[model samples]
Target: MGKEILDLAEWKSTLTAFAKERDWEKFHTPKNLATALSVEASELLELFQWLTAEESTLLPQKNKDEKLRKNIEREMADVLVYLLRLATVLEVDLSKALQEKMAENAKKYPADKVKGLSKKYDQY
Candidate 1:
Protein backbone atom coordinates (compact mmCIF):
# COMPACT_ATOMS: atom_id res chain seq x y z
CA MET A 1 0.00 0.00 0.00
CA GLY A 2 1.07 3.59 -0.59
CA LYS A 3 1.01 6.55 1.75
CA GLU A 4 -2.31 8.39 1.83
CA ILE A 5 -2.71 12.01 0.79
CA LEU A 6 -5.08 13.86 3.06
CA ASP A 7 -6.33 16.42 0.56
CA LEU A 8 -5.77 18.30 -2.68
CA ALA A 9 -3.41 20.73 -1.03
CA GLU A 10 -1.19 17.91 0.13
CA TRP A 11 -1.14 16.34 -3.29
CA LYS A 12 -0.24 19.66 -4.85
CA SER A 13 2.50 20.30 -2.37
CA THR A 14 3.92 16.83 -2.83
CA LEU A 15 3.86 17.06 -6.60
CA THR A 16 5.37 20.52 -6.49
CA ALA A 17 8.19 19.24 -4.34
CA PHE A 18 8.76 16.38 -6.73
CA ALA A 19 9.02 18.71 -9.70
CA LYS A 20 11.25 21.08 -7.82
CA GLU A 21 13.58 18.27 -6.77
CA ARG A 22 13.94 17.21 -10.37
CA ASP A 23 14.23 20.81 -11.68
CA TRP A 24 11.23 20.08 -13.85
CA GLU A 25 9.01 22.89 -12.61
CA LYS A 26 10.17 25.14 -15.46
CA PHE A 27 8.59 22.77 -17.98
CA HIS A 28 5.25 22.59 -16.18
CA THR A 29 3.59 25.48 -17.94
CA PRO A 30 -0.20 25.41 -18.31
CA LYS A 31 -0.07 24.42 -21.97
CA ASN A 32 2.55 21.78 -21.38
CA LEU A 33 0.69 20.39 -18.41
CA ALA A 34 -2.52 20.24 -20.39
CA THR A 35 -0.76 18.39 -23.18
CA ALA A 36 0.82 15.97 -20.75
CA LEU A 37 -2.59 15.49 -19.18
CA SER A 38 -4.10 14.59 -22.52
CA VAL A 39 -1.32 12.12 -23.27
CA GLU A 40 -1.72 10.47 -19.88
CA ALA A 41 -5.49 10.29 -20.29
CA SER A 42 -4.99 8.66 -23.69
CA GLU A 43 -2.63 6.13 -22.17
CA LEU A 44 -5.20 5.29 -19.52
CA LEU A 45 -7.90 4.90 -22.16
CA GLU A 46 -5.61 2.66 -24.20
CA LEU A 47 -5.56 0.16 -21.35
CA PHE A 48 -9.13 -0.79 -22.24
CA GLN A 49 -8.79 -0.35 -26.00
CA TRP A 50 -9.75 -3.89 -27.11
CA LEU A 51 -11.85 -5.20 -24.26
CA THR A 52 -15.57 -5.89 -24.56
CA ALA A 53 -17.88 -3.99 -22.24
CA GLU A 54 -17.79 -6.70 -19.63
CA GLU A 55 -14.05 -7.18 -19.99
CA SER A 56 -13.48 -3.47 -19.69
CA THR A 57 -15.57 -3.28 -16.55
CA LEU A 58 -13.80 -6.28 -15.11
CA LEU A 59 -10.30 -4.98 -15.92
CA PRO A 60 -7.61 -6.71 -13.89
CA GLN A 61 -10.62 -8.19 -12.06
CA LYS A 62 -11.81 -11.16 -14.07
CA ASN A 63 -8.21 -12.20 -14.57
CA LYS A 64 -7.01 -11.01 -11.16
CA ASP A 65 -3.81 -9.62 -12.70
CA GLU A 66 -1.97 -7.41 -10.20
CA LYS A 67 0.31 -6.01 -12.90
CA LEU A 68 -2.63 -4.95 -15.02
CA ARG A 69 -4.29 -3.23 -12.11
CA LYS A 70 -1.01 -1.51 -11.20
CA ASN A 71 -0.57 -0.30 -14.75
CA ILE A 72 -4.06 1.17 -14.72
CA GLU A 73 -3.48 2.77 -11.35
CA ARG A 74 -0.20 4.35 -12.49
CA GLU A 75 -1.71 5.72 -15.69
CA MET A 76 -4.66 7.13 -13.75
CA ALA A 77 -2.31 8.73 -11.26
CA ASP A 78 -0.33 10.32 -14.06
CA VAL A 79 -3.50 11.83 -15.50
CA LEU A 80 -4.59 13.20 -12.14
CA VAL A 81 -1.15 14.52 -11.29
CA TYR A 82 -0.98 16.49 -14.50
CA LEU A 83 -4.52 17.77 -14.07
CA LEU A 84 -3.77 18.99 -10.56
CA ARG A 85 -0.58 20.61 -11.75
CA LEU A 86 -2.43 22.36 -14.55
CA ALA A 87 -5.11 23.60 -12.17
CA THR A 88 -2.45 24.90 -9.85
CA VAL A 89 -0.64 26.67 -12.68
CA LEU A 90 -3.89 28.26 -13.86
CA GLU A 91 -4.99 29.25 -10.35
CA VAL A 92 -8.25 27.36 -10.79
CA ASP A 93 -10.24 26.20 -7.81
CA LEU A 94 -11.14 22.66 -8.87
CA SER A 95 -13.52 22.03 -5.98
CA LYS A 96 -15.55 25.15 -6.74
CA ALA A 97 -15.48 24.43 -10.47
CA LEU A 98 -16.71 20.88 -9.89
CA GLN A 99 -19.51 22.14 -7.66
CA GLU A 100 -20.61 24.72 -10.23
CA LYS A 101 -20.47 22.19 -13.07
CA MET A 102 -22.46 19.63 -11.09
CA ALA A 103 -25.09 22.26 -10.33
CA GLU A 104 -25.34 23.15 -14.02
CA ASN A 105 -25.54 19.44 -14.92
CA ALA A 106 -28.36 18.88 -12.43
CA LYS A 107 -30.30 21.74 -13.93
CA LYS A 108 -29.60 20.59 -17.48
CA TYR A 109 -30.29 16.93 -16.81
CA PRO A 110 -32.85 16.86 -14.08
CA ALA A 111 -33.38 13.29 -12.97
CA ASP A 112 -37.14 13.49 -13.21
CA LYS A 113 -36.88 14.21 -16.92
CA VAL A 114 -33.79 12.28 -17.88
CA LYS A 115 -33.88 9.21 -15.75
CA GLY A 116 -32.28 6.19 -17.49
CA LEU A 117 -31.70 8.37 -20.56
CA SER A 118 -28.33 8.54 -22.30
CA LYS A 119 -28.92 11.56 -24.54
CA LYS A 120 -27.02 14.77 -24.21
CA TYR A 121 -28.57 17.51 -22.08
CA ASP A 122 -29.17 19.70 -25.11
CA GLN A 123 -30.90 16.88 -26.96
CA TYR A 124 -33.45 16.37 -24.23
Candidate 2:
Protein backbone atom coordinates (compact mmCIF):
# COMPACT_ATOMS: atom_id res chain seq x y z
CA MET A 1 0.00 0.00 0.00
CA GLY A 2 1.10 3.54 -0.61
CA LYS A 3 1.43 6.23 2.00
CA GLU A 4 -1.36 8.75 2.40
CA ILE A 5 -0.97 12.14 0.74
CA LEU A 6 -2.06 15.38 2.39
CA ASP A 7 -2.64 18.65 0.60
CA LEU A 8 -1.90 22.07 2.08
CA ALA A 9 -5.49 22.58 3.25
CA GLU A 10 -5.41 19.27 5.08
CA TRP A 11 -2.13 20.13 6.74
CA LYS A 12 -3.44 23.52 7.78
CA SER A 13 -6.57 21.98 9.23
CA THR A 14 -4.56 19.39 11.12
CA LEU A 15 -2.23 21.99 12.53
CA THR A 16 -5.12 24.21 13.52
CA ALA A 17 -6.82 21.32 15.27
CA PHE A 18 -3.63 20.42 17.07
CA ALA A 19 -3.13 23.93 18.33
CA LYS A 20 -6.73 24.32 19.31
CA GLU A 21 -6.68 21.03 21.22
CA ARG A 22 -3.79 22.25 23.30
CA ASP A 23 -5.05 25.80 23.64
CA TRP A 24 -1.87 26.82 21.86
CA GLU A 25 -3.42 28.94 19.14
CA LYS A 26 -3.13 32.03 21.32
CA PHE A 27 0.62 31.53 21.43
CA HIS A 28 0.91 30.95 17.68
CA THR A 29 1.00 34.58 16.65
CA PRO A 30 2.90 35.40 13.49
CA LYS A 31 5.90 36.71 15.43
CA ASN A 32 6.03 33.69 17.73
CA LEU A 33 5.65 31.28 14.83
CA ALA A 34 8.39 32.99 12.86
CA THR A 35 10.71 32.86 15.85
CA ALA A 36 9.91 29.19 16.39
CA LEU A 37 10.50 28.50 12.70
CA SER A 38 13.91 30.15 12.88
CA VAL A 39 14.80 28.13 15.98
CA GLU A 40 13.75 24.90 14.30
CA ALA A 41 15.77 25.82 11.20
CA SER A 42 18.80 26.40 13.41
CA GLU A 43 18.29 23.01 15.02
CA LEU A 44 18.19 21.43 11.57
CA LEU A 45 21.38 23.25 10.61
CA GLU A 46 23.10 22.08 13.78
CA LEU A 47 22.73 18.49 12.58
CA PHE A 48 24.97 19.26 9.60
CA GLN A 49 27.53 21.32 11.51
CA TRP A 50 31.16 20.12 11.20
CA LEU A 51 30.17 17.51 8.60
CA THR A 52 31.98 17.50 5.28
CA ALA A 53 29.73 18.41 2.36
CA GLU A 54 29.65 14.81 1.13
CA GLU A 55 29.00 13.47 4.64
CA SER A 56 26.06 15.86 5.02
CA THR A 57 24.64 14.68 1.72
CA LEU A 58 24.98 11.03 2.74
CA LEU A 59 23.42 11.42 6.18
CA PRO A 60 20.17 9.65 5.31
CA GLN A 61 21.83 6.49 4.02
CA LYS A 62 20.55 3.39 5.77
CA ASN A 63 24.00 2.09 6.61
CA LYS A 64 24.72 5.21 8.66
CA ASP A 65 22.15 4.13 11.30
CA GLU A 66 18.71 5.65 11.77
CA LYS A 67 19.28 7.95 14.74
CA LEU A 68 20.91 10.83 12.91
CA ARG A 69 18.50 10.55 10.01
CA LYS A 70 15.52 10.55 12.37
CA ASN A 71 16.83 13.63 14.13
CA ILE A 72 17.21 15.43 10.82
CA GLU A 73 13.71 14.46 9.75
CA ARG A 74 12.23 15.58 13.05
CA GLU A 75 13.99 18.93 12.94
CA MET A 76 12.97 19.45 9.33
CA ALA A 77 9.36 18.68 10.19
CA ASP A 78 9.52 21.15 13.07
CA VAL A 79 10.77 23.86 10.74
CA LEU A 80 8.07 23.14 8.18
CA VAL A 81 5.32 23.03 10.78
CA TYR A 82 6.27 26.36 12.24
CA LEU A 83 6.60 27.91 8.81
CA LEU A 84 3.18 26.66 7.82
CA ARG A 85 1.73 27.92 11.07
CA LEU A 86 3.26 31.33 10.48
CA ALA A 87 1.95 31.48 6.94
CA THR A 88 -1.51 30.51 8.08
CA VAL A 89 -1.52 33.09 10.82
CA LEU A 90 -0.36 35.74 8.39
CA GLU A 91 -2.82 34.63 5.67
CA VAL A 92 0.02 34.04 3.25
CA ASP A 93 -0.48 31.63 0.38
CA LEU A 94 2.76 29.69 0.49
CA SER A 95 2.26 27.91 -2.83
CA LYS A 96 1.69 31.13 -4.73
CA ALA A 97 4.51 32.86 -2.86
CA LEU A 98 6.97 30.09 -3.68
CA GLN A 99 6.00 30.07 -7.33
CA GLU A 100 6.38 33.86 -7.55
CA LYS A 101 9.74 33.69 -5.80
CA MET A 102 10.92 30.95 -8.15
CA ALA A 103 9.94 33.08 -11.11
CA GLU A 104 11.79 36.07 -9.66
CA ASN A 105 14.85 33.91 -9.00
CA ALA A 106 14.80 32.59 -12.54
CA LYS A 107 14.87 36.12 -13.87
CA LYS A 108 17.67 37.05 -11.47
CA TYR A 109 19.71 33.90 -12.20
CA PRO A 110 19.08 33.09 -15.80
CA ALA A 111 20.54 29.74 -16.79
CA ASP A 112 22.22 31.07 -19.95
CA LYS A 113 24.13 33.73 -18.04
CA VAL A 114 24.57 32.23 -14.60
CA LYS A 115 25.22 28.62 -15.45
CA GLY A 116 27.67 26.90 -13.05
CA LEU A 117 28.11 30.18 -11.15
CA SER A 118 27.46 30.77 -7.46
CA LYS A 119 27.57 34.55 -7.41
CA LYS A 120 24.65 36.69 -6.27
CA TYR A 121 22.35 38.05 -8.97
CA ASP A 122 23.82 41.55 -8.85
CA GLN A 123 27.40 40.21 -8.79
CA TYR A 124 26.93 37.87 -11.74
Give per-residue CA lDDT, model 1, range 2-58, as digits (tens): 997548877888998999999999999999999999999999988888878987677
Model 2 misplaced regions, further than 4 Å: 1-6
- What is the TM-score of candidate 1? 0.90
Consecutive 10-residue window with the lowest summed lDDT within model 1: 56-65
lDDT for 22 in candidate 1 is: 98
TM-score of each: 0.90, 0.91
Model 1 stretches astray by more than 4 angstroms:
1-6, 60-63
